[model samples]
Target: MTSSRLAHEHDEHVCPRFHRAIELVGKRWNGAVIRALMDRPRRFGEILEAVPDLHDRLLSERLKELESEQIVQRRVYPETPVRIEYALTQRGRDLERILAEVERWAHRWLPQPSKS
Candidate 1:
């Protein structure tokens, strides 16, 4: 189907604010990062490994954006070398319920084909 047609289909099922929320979460690699963080805080290298396809520049930019929006918190430790980690803030934790629901929908409707 066309992009506009698919969008219209979504509009019929979602309100404007919820659609915008989905848009924010659906940005490139944003959802993947959020899903990764759902388990626990991760170091930058850990996150990079979890999202193997993510470019360092794009990942860094997305992390900073999420930090500015208060969705994620970045902690840096001072030492011989710097230690940094990213964890979800309370607001980000609130997204767990919504993300779970989306996960369920995806599992139900987007299942992968079984290998022969």
Candidate 2:
């Protein structure tokens, strides 16, 4: 009946799914990379430019992780230079609704800076 106990019980039910999701997308720059690929396919350099703060090494690792998750696909064009592009898979696109909802919630409840 206590508030702490209630929160503990609620966490027990929510933490597994929450933690698993965080493990996948909460890693540094992972969410940004996903967002970058949301609209259309982008080349590796394009993704790096999209997330200006992310370093090349970390970006490479995150892309490989996403590819393994099946949320992203890596396509290689059989052209002269072997153009490579990264795109969001259908599974990745499924996060759009959830991301939009999160954005809405953050705008409502999170702090905003004053335009002094």
lDDT of 2 by residue, 29-100 (tens): 888899898889999999999987799999999999999999899999999989999999998898878777
Residue pairs of candidate 2 with colliding backbone atoms: none
Model 1 poorest ten-residue lDDT run:
11-20
- Model 1 superposed RMSD (Cα): 7.1
Candidate 2's C-alpha runs over 4 A off are 1-12, 109-116
Residue-level lDDT tens digits of model 1 in 1-116: 89999799797776688777778899888888888898999998889899867988898999998898799999998976988999999988999999899889999999786767
Least accurate 10 contiguous residues by lDDT in model 2: 11-20
Clashing pairs in 1: none
Each model's lDDT: 0.88, 0.88
